[model samples]
Target: MMSFDLIGRLFGSVRDRDGRADVLEKLAQHEPTLPAPRNPSAPEELLPVALATKVLAGWLANRQQTLVPHTLNFRVLGPAQADLLLAVMAAAIQADGEIDSREARQLSLALRRVGAGEDEARRIGAMLAEPQHLGTLLTRIQEADLATHAYAAALLAINRGTRVNRAFLDYVSARLGLVPDVAGSLERRYRA
Candidate 1:
């Protein structure tokens, strides 16, 4: 099941103000505790569940599926995949030559959400601090699920729709051996 919070974010920000409220209300029926986005910046937080919401949205788009908002659950990534996602997400943010404070914070929260251990987080941190080879980092992944999740996380981490990210995602999808449409689908859906 998806987390109600994540679901709320998924459905909440995609529409106009009244539409957003209607969706949030539907979500609140499932999760009474769901708070409206605190401020206008919250269209982003309208998915404060941001990373999860956006990531999950990408996942669904990839599979051409949908879910019940109330019965949602966030998939917890395993340690290795978590590290890969962190690296991928971090690299995506860094691709434009700088990491915005907000972008870094989203990945940090994702790191916390992934439950990456201290040593692992430190290692990934060191890795991120250096230059990255997007292709090389992806070579060890042989699983389709990991590839998809990694792509989604990286796509979500894009600060804005920069050309650098477009290129980076193209390279990442090729490295991960995803169907070419995966990156374009995600970019069109989320980043567009």
Candidate 2:
């Protein structure tokens, strides 16, 4: 419920303008809202699995909507969809030929947030370790909403630091059939 409310507030905040900074601030401020698991020894003590997934999904949707509204919808994704998203992100992170430490760390954090065990996360990582035909994967996404959200996730993962992975981004965008300007806008927002 708290996650749902947070997502609603996040959507409202981003509706009028580019509220990415605001959304990030809210995510940081509201992380404490996620309840701890019943098992004291659980790895995800800082954030609940469901809540974390919702937060990530909301952020992706917000990013997509802010940059390209027609293709993506701002909504929380279910667990299966989250797994697919993680796979896409993993592929994106590896798109540049080598996985940077920061990108690996980010991917690990995302996997943990979805409550993926080490083996499961490794499985997902292995599945995407090789260069993948992003267009084929995009087609398997079923819904336009998920595909767009996955695109946003890929963009977030790939556009790190001073240099942008333009070639890789362009390839994925072309595979996804995104307008050049929309993909450029998403890249620019992160670059700024």
Candidate 3:
């Protein structure tokens, strides 16, 4: 989920480190080896990732930047988590029963550029059926962090003013067991 192109967009310094062309080139050149999922019961599971997020979140807060950007990296995601993100992104784009849009095209391009293969793309296309698919995706999210990430990704994918988009988000919030306040906070971050 942590697409280098995405990380490059959010963090200018990272993009600048090797030059823009080089950063995108890395995406095509190397498929990042995502680490296997950690034992959830263990306290130190993905400690570096958690710490890095905390640090970036803190740094962004200090600089008056929105928290949304730092939290969007899917690089640390395991297979199930990655699938969930792709599914939600596709669902949001298709929620209103219409999938033709610039957003849909952009997502397709991003997913491909990030090296999503034919299988995952097919799964995402199949998963746009709604309530059941959304429920199925939510179940794969065991960690609270993952649930939050998926919800955030959905929020980013959606056009909030659309009735179907709003409804899809409402269902996702309830199904994910995200409390109203936490859900509101996530929404507000994207709204900003």
lDDT values of the candidates?
A: 0.63, 0.63, 0.69
lDDT (10s digit) by residue, model 2, range 13-43: 7454553476766578854656765675766
Q: Against the true structure, what is every candidate's RMSD? A: 18.8, 18.6, 22.2
Per-residue lDDT value at 117 in model 3: 68
Candidate 1 runs further than 4 Å off: 1-63, 66-75, 109-123, 143-145, 184-192
Instruction: Rate residue 191 of model 3 by lDDT.
Output: 55
Please, what is the TM-score per model?
Answer: 0.49, 0.46, 0.49
Clash list (residue pairs), candidate 3: 1-74, 1-75, 2-74, 2-75
Instruction: Please write out the lDDT profile of model 1 over residues 118-185, one tens digit for every residue.
Output: 66557667877888776666765544346766776676676555677678878778877777655555
lDDT of 3 by residue, 16-124 (tens): 5534576567666877777697568876777887999998888866543343343555556667777778777776777777765755665666555445667767877
Q: What is the lDDT of residue 116 in candidate 3?
A: 63
Best by lDDT: 3
> Using TM-score as the measure, what is the rank order of every candidate, best first?
3, 1, 2
Please report, as a residue range, the 10-residue window in candidate 3 with the lowest summed lDDT: 62-71
